[model samples]
Target: MGTFKIEGGHQLKGKIQPQGAKNEALQILCAVLLTPELVTINNIPDIIDVNKLINLLKKLGVKVENIGKGSYTFQADEVNLEYLESDAFKIDGRGLRGSIMIVGPLLARFGKGYIPKPGGDKIGRRRLDTHFEGLINLGAKFRYSKEDQFYGVEAEYLTGTYMLLEEASVTGTANIVMAAVLARGTTTIYNAACEPYLQQLCKMLNRMGAKISGVGSNMLIIEGVKALGGTEHRMLPDMIEIGSWIGLAAMTKSELTITNVSWDDLGVIPSVFRKLGITVEKQGDDIHIPAHTNGYEIQSYIDGSILTISDAPWPGFTPDLLSIILVVATQARGSVLIHQKMFESRLFFVDKLIDMGAKIILCDPHRATVIGHDFKSTLKATTMTSPDIRAGVSLLIAALSAKGTSTIQNIEQIDRGYENIDSRLRAIGAKIERVD
Candidate 1:
């Protein structure tokens, strides 16, 4: 396992650019299989999960070429359908959760799609029923193998229909839309996830000759096209990474500028950070965070009640950044409650922060109460292990603001999302190094 050795209590300055959105890259890569023409994608982040999916595409006979820095062109004209039954494919497909999305495109273009049970963060139960159920609603026959833990969907021809999703799942909505684009009739999806990434996917499909409307709305309408053509797409900057950098600047009392962040797309992120007393200033397309020399204070309700930050669907705060918020609140001037509504085990990392002498209460599996140290007390460094991607970055931020050196194990979790994180931090005067 790789590790990170960090020297704490150092202030970082200079500018950092957020990488391509990891969530959007996964969806856009899977959508490449929907067309036979050349699809050129720019701003592809060089991360483990995204690279794994690209390798899987190559093994399936998709012709892929690296055109430039963070740019790739893919053509899936001669996909190897037979490879899906191989033992090698079973092992490769089980490496990441994003592999599940390939099934929708394959089933839509070809006649069949198969995938092994995917593996990802051990945060909680992320069921695949939403994906399969959505495909089944589009006239596809679904089958599952209990002994092998594999899922398969097949159909001679799919006919579109209306569907109201039980939950507004991002991946599920993306999967079903990819399939419905090639169906026989109009498909209307109500209660669809309107995340900017999903909206990007829908807009990209429209550019590829698929008829889709209602961009950036909860309801989507897709009209089946005979075939889709090639189109170019550029991914947006990762908002989650941008949020992490904001928290990092506040926690370490540094002045850092995050460049090229899509300000309008970052819904409620800036406001939520401001609620924690951090300065998120907009200087054109970039976000400039000044040093919090006196520490920040959490805001209370209009009725003078304690502040509670919770995650919900789009237009609400993202659950992925809750870990960063919890870590940043440790040194703020007042208290805040972080309610992680989507995943159960995401809050379990608080014990490690508590070990570092931060005042935190693990209210339960879904909530945590943070009592800010207000910079009067500095966190003492300690050795720890990373449990997941978000938690790993949160711990790294905590270590950077701590009083001494700290060692973090299993940094592969951190590498899964962020691209060249240590080098990026080093350029901004951070004392972080990768150790093998």
Candidate 2:
């Protein structure tokens, strides 16, 4: 296990470049398995999860060549589907939910796909029933074997049709889209996830000869084709990390600029942060954060009352970022309620925040009202362990702002998302050291 030791009360000041999104890179990598030709991807985040997925792909006989900094050429000219039966092939699948996405492309290209149950944050019950249902609608046969704890799918000829997902699952929608791209007919998907990551996936698939429309909306219309070719793509900068940097600058009164941020793709995220009293200035592809901000006051409703911040599916505030927003809100001048509707267990970390001598109310598993103390370097340090990626970042925010030294353990969860986080924080003057 690894931990972060931080010396608090130092302001982070400097410019930083955000890393490529881990979520988007995962789906795009799996899409590589759809074609044997060469696919070159640039700006790929060098994170733990991305590395794990790449290792898993290499074990399946995909020839991956590094073409320089943050660039790689992947050639899956000969996929050894036999590896799907080995225990080594199942290592990444059981540890990350993104591993489940490989099932769709493997089945589409090789006629058969074997995948074990996926593992991710235990925030709630992440069911694969919807993924299975979506594939079955595409003329695929599914079988579950208890001996291997694997789900097998086979299809001689896949035909696409209309699919209404049970929920707007991020990876589930991705799996179905990849499978539908090469099917026999047109595929219509309703209530699909339209996150920017998904939109990028659709665009990449289209460049590879899959006709997909409504890229940024819930209703996707995919015109299936016989085959897809390899294409070059550059992964988008991580919005979640950009958001975290914004929160860091606001909380620490630091001047920071995030380079290479896509302003057009960040729908509702900038406005959401502005509502929390954070100002974001966009200059071309850069997001500039002004220094020495007083942690703006949360604006009240028209009736002059407190307001609330909540999360929803795409086009709304993302649930993954609410934790970071809440931590930032804790230093603001007013009160706000954070309602996490997506996960029942995400708000459990507020107790740790409360133990740090902050004013907070754990209304339940789904809601927490945070009162900003504006301590501004008055909080005493403490020991805590990270629970998830987003929460881990939030803890780092808290640790960085505390009055004394603080220790945060189990940073592997954080490494799964952010790339070279400790070094990046060091670049901005955050006094954090990583120890194993």
Give lDDT per model, in order.
Answer: 0.96, 0.88
Q: Per-residue lDDT of 278-383 in model 1, one digit per residue for the tens?
A: 9999999999999999889999999988899999989788999999999999999889999999998999999999999999999999999999999999999999
Q: For model 2, how does the per-residue alpha-carbon lDDT over 1-436 read when each residue is reduced to its tens digit?
A: 9999999878888899999988899999999999888999999999888898898899889999999888999999989888998887766568777888998999888888888887777687778887889999999999998876889889997898998888998888999999999988899999999999999999999998899998999999988888899899999999899899988888787889999889887788888888877788988899998974555677677897787889998888888899898888888878899999999899888777888877889999998998887655355689999999999999899888887899999999999899989999998899999999
Clashing pairs in 1: none
Could you estimate the TM-score for every candidate? 0.99, 0.97
What local lDDT does model 2 show for residue 80?
Answer: 88
Worst 10 residues of 2 by lDDT: 372-381
User: Model 2, residue 326: what's the lDDT?
Assistant: 89
Write down the lDDT that model 1 would get: 0.96
Candidate achieving the largest TM-score = 1
For candidate 1, the 10 contiguous residues with the lowest summed lDDT are: 125-134
Off by over 4 Å in 2: 146-148
